[model samples]
Target: MTSDCLFCRIVAGEIPATVVHETDATLAFRDIAPKAPVHVLVVPKAHYADVAELAKADPALAGQVLAAGAAVADAEGLTQDGFRVIFNAGEHGGQEVFHVHAHVLGGRPLGPMVSS
Candidate 1:
């Protein structure tokens, strides 16, 4: 785990978080600065810079992270009403956190997410 990486810190329990889900491969937790009522971040335990980084080192891990995201939505009961899974790639995309993570959002109408 990267000592300076926030996500790694979360995984290491250096920081406190309201956990939503966890597995051998990943962890899901409530976002400290949430955008929605059900905003959660799903990340791999092992650090990767971003999607571009993850895609090469562990393609299976990338798919697993996405699968876990769906599991989080299902567990949170956001599937019926519908939910959105998003990953911001870089600074240009408003990715304040460098570690690869998927944001699971729902529980209310998400209008024009791509408009911005």
Candidate 2:
């Protein structure tokens, strides 16, 4: 875990987050700023600069992150209707934090995948 990473701090218990689910390799928590009624961030315990780095370095752990996101959606009752899992990467992708995280969003109709 990088000492400077925000998610790493959360994983290390240096910062407080409203966690929803946890596993040996993953942690799911609610987003402080929710765009949807149900918005959760699923992240791997191990730090990665972004999803691409995580996927390339440890595919299994990346899968675990996806599984945790699915679990979060199911637990939040988003499985029935539908949900969106987003991994914002870099500045162009709108990533505010360096640590890789999956944003699981649902609870209502999420209009479009992207807006112009």
* Tens-digit lDDT track of model 1 for 1-116: 89999999999999999999999999999988788889999999999989889999999999999999999999999999999999899999878889999999988898977332
lDDT of 2 by residue, 7-112 (tens): 9999989999999999999999999989889889999999999999999999999999999999999899999999999999999999999999999999888887
Candidate 2's error at 27, in angstroms?
0.5
**Segments in model 2 whose C-alpha atoms lie over 4 Å from true places:** 114-116
List clashing residue pairs in candidate 1: none
lDDT of 1: 0.92
Give lDDT: candidate 2, residue 84: 97
True lDDT of residue 33, candidate 1: 76
